[model samples]
Target: MTRMECRRSLSAPTGTENDTRISTHENESECNEIPQSKSYPVFKNIGTSQCLNASQEVSDTGQCCHPSLMGLANGHCSNVLEFFKDIPQDVRKCLVEFLSSGVTDDLEIHEGNFHHFFHVANHLNLRRLLQCCVEVYEKGDKTRIKEKIGMCECVHYLEQLVATAYRRETSVLWHEKDLDSDRKFQVLFLTKDKHARKQPVVVIDFARNFKIYKQDIEKADKVGVGFCACAFEQDGCPYIFVSGGEEKKKSQIWQYDVILDKWSKAGKMLHGRSRHLMVAVKDKIYLIGGQNVACIEEFDPISGKCVEIGSLPVAAWSSTYAVNNDTIYIFGGKNPAGCISTVQSFNCKTNRIARLGDLPCACSGSRAVVLGDFIFIATSEGHLIKFNPMDGSSELCALQPFIRRHFVMFVRNERIYITGGVRKSNDKGADENHLYKYTPETDTWSDVATLSTSLPVYTYCTVRYSGKCIIVPFEKFR
Candidate 1:
């Protein structure tokens, strides 16, 4: 019963200043008849001079006492916690008082009490305890703090560390509201102008939501070309089929149905479409650019046909596209003549395609995805371009890492997952079933889980269902 009570009493921190006297007497005693009830060894080690001073905190009956130290020279130390639950309250108080401000930072007074000490130090926001924590961590192995809460570099002194850390964590979560919904919105501060910047961003696609709708998401009514079977899916897939087929007839704009779990029909346009840029805004899908022609068309997958929205101010198909609110940005696409860095955009509501800006370098077939507010343009030839929509201006990301691939992909989950695609470079030529995952934290790409087959590079669309990213085989949309 006494042992159980002692354990319960020590569970809470106490500041006992007594218990030091009689400790030496017990240590030097040759008497084997001492009663077990009062023979605990915690107080039996103090020498005569210290034992006398220790008695000042003892009660009149010679029993241990707990009292705040007043005018003892140093300030009152934080309550040091005991790791063992069964310790007597008197002992816990004595230990805390002894190790208060006077204790050495590098030494552990009690063995096996590290966790209790650290927890209490963190909770009380004590500087001395924090210093002790840092010392213990430095003296011990890295595994000690490997999986700890608020994990990070340790401070040398505990003084206000615990209190400061709590406030920091609380504020960090305030800026992370949309993070839980798997949707993020960020504004880029590139020195460019003349673009709409309103749209919910779906980033880190592989780890979260599946599909794309931003920038130029327009709803088309009964729009298709030639023969139409009809394939329109919900939130439809965000993936775009921007690849230009060898023949003009091969390049096509298609949409995948995320809900129906199949790719459906989108209206074919009057002109033969190849190497076109497709972006969804509001309720309409804008198919921009084609080989030997700089024409743009809007397709209504529900209607199963296309309408000539307007022609781009430039002559190029297969141009790289980025969308910001109502604008479908076209940049760095090769014309029948050669590679051009011309920038253009199609406003869905305005019904027009206008030149916006130019690229830092003339390149095409690169991947452009939004991270935060700035659009990160990774060229097929391995150059990173940053374009600001507000004004038509772009710059090269010389310090950023670049991975080149031909397949069109999306930005989601803070990562840029690139599936299999052809690459042509002497130092980095890749043409296999390549699946790569990149972490923006380290700005590096590493190989992870791979797909059974290379992503279908249709001149059309693809959808991810359950855990499968299925691409509708696009022999013909109509």
Candidate 2:
């Protein structure tokens, strides 16, 4: 299914009282009192026998709280609130009791109080209370609530809110599942700019309609030059381990604390490697290949140490890898001669390496990701290869837009995204600001968003976490 986008139909929170007053008429039932088994603590404390009047603003604050409540206009409640004086005393009492402390079980929902409570709650943006009102209305005479809601001044907004509440109440589980699946993972993009004072981090939140934000390292943390980073979670906290550098920074690994926004030296590789592939499997991280090193070493985040488990059967440089269970599939890479089509699999459990099959063509400077039973590889040649390990079958589809090599690719929520790495007209490697999203289901590509800065090739990785909004909004959202 296509991902759901979050859009605001109504104005954003204004931090003030709702100014839309409908001048509703007081129902005749307002004069009648209904005895309740429960007592109103807030009402008693405020020295009031009934809920606050609709036109009554809390003191001189010019704002209202729960309809059944009064005297809460102080800076206590920040959410938008409204009151309808025309609602009956008992219905206002129920609204106040429900909205005040979020108690709905004891609120007597009879025919006399249904229409008033539903309309008031819907108007006040009390979604929970409106949902309760919808449940009660659905159990009784639905036609009456329909007519009552249809008669509201802003019939469109009123009926829309009513239908939303009704749908939410009926398919709550389905809605919850859809939300969880769509927004569960957050994608983070980091740039490799050693000259910058602090590292630039881009956080993408799919929950908020693919919202993008920027952050700094906050502390004196900077990624080393010529670094290859891998995003992994340690102890339930997201982290990015960056390795590879030149001179003094070589072989050193840095652990970035995503939560604290701090960076510290984590560990060092046994061999300083460049053009290598780093992947996280379970709790351990595997650093494979290098310009010359053929050994594959495993690094333990907890111990902060690297140990060489085995060596590649055929050492290949500039190779990419994808892990499935205990096995890691090493894709095409360059050697001393040139790019090689050799494919190899290393089993972490067995500590063994075996040749799988050759690629349709050598794919140096490529990226690979596993989706279901197939592995999708995006080559620098602008070709997408789908490889099936079961039968050793491979199919290549050339990306028309990506006529030149140098783009970066990453997968989130089973969708592939390519950005940056465009060869400029100057015949020089430059950053391409355009971001493209590819969907395997339809085998189609669409430009999604342009980045504030070009994404560096092999210098970015996605970390999943609960993120916050940024001060600088992405151009796409604006």
Candidate 3:
């Protein structure tokens, strides 16, 4: 999809209140008397007889004259017509009681009020109302409310309610799995200065909020730009491996101890390859597709040895790959002829590569991640394609116009976040400074947050450790 089309689809509807307003004549016939129920404690305090008489008078005369309910009869109560239009009679009555009260101390009251409020808001397509609820919960004082609920508890409940409403409304588009178990993880970024040729590893801890710390690694001759890095476990310890970027340098590999904050040499690859992709499957780390290399190399961390296992059908470079079960799926890269759209799956058990299918378009320097049963690839053209390996089918689903060459894509919890790529425009815009989030369940793209520093296209390596995203820059800071 083009950028304009994507924006139109995501744009909010306008003039909803004017188009769906309920007439005062209809209100007179329908809501003549406020229902008498235990759920409506606010009405009891106002004196039911007096409240009903006032409601009837206002509904009939179209004038909110009652002093007691003047506030409700004017602003808040105006929403009742649209709110109750779709909601069931029982739910509407209960909601009216709770919302009319405006505040409550009972846990059940809080739950019931928010539950139906969300439903009503969704039914009316009141996105602003939902957003207001979130904003109020985040920024408003919880202590001032009658419920005495903690801010954290209120936010949690609000998220749950929204998720439930999203599922009910968009079941087909919604992802079945919940991300409640996903925790915040720290990110490690390796940045370089082009002029001085200085590379420093920066660690960002998001677990206890976001904090950044930088550490300098003992630089290697070959470890500069276009190098491949991935997080792997040796024995039970976690470590990061960096390998093969500079052609003049030998096939040297370096390992960094994440816990000790130290760097050391590891086993070298058989071939000096740059712009390759690395993923750890089970006990072995597999490096595939880079520059002129067609051969797939596997490194055993335990033995500190590297061996060539398989070769691609053609020489591929700058492609992205993700692992599922025992197979690694690689997609989109440039060959000698130019960019290719081939998808290849390498099965570890068989020790062979098989052609799965092709991408919708040829893409190089793209990124891929496995979520559930599908492998999602973010293309250089800013289109997101999901490939189902089971049936060998590929479909273009989402569009992100800012994704150009050299961007990094990673998944946290269940959402995919893309950072640091150039924009597809004549200006050669600085998209590297922004971070975008792709929600698979909704097939929408949104700008979430900005990065501390802009990343050069295809000059950085990213890995997720302990639920955090770590970035290592290979290009000079612009």
Candidate with top lDDT is 2
Q: Name the regions of candidate 1 deviating beyond 4 angstroms.
A: 1-266, 398-403, 407-409, 415-419, 426-478
lDDT of 1 by residue, 1-478 (tens): 1221121121223333222221111222321221223321111111112322343221122211112111111122222222223344544554344232224433453424554555444433333444555555556653545344233222222323333342221111111322222222111111111232321111112221111111212222212221111122233233232213332344344453321112334435666655566666656666666666567767765575678868888887556666687777778778767888888877888886677667878876666776666677767676766677766677765432334454544454455655544444445433234445555566565654333333323222223322111111110110
Worst 10 residues of 2 by lDDT: 1-10
The residue-by-residue lDDT of candidate 3 on 345-446, one tens digit each, is 899778888887788889877778888889899888888999998988999987885646656676754778777655666665545656677778899887
Where's the lowest-lDDT run of ten residues in candidate 1?
469-478
Which one wins by lDDT: 1 or 3? 3
The candidate that achieves the highest TM-score relative to the unseen native structure = 2
| Per-residue accuracy of model 2 over 165-203 as CA lDDT, tens digit each | 444432211232332222223333344455666555555
Which sequence of candidate numbers ranks them by lDDT, best first? 2, 3, 1
Off by over 4 Å in 2: 1-194, 218-222, 404-406, 412-415, 424-431, 437-454, 466-478
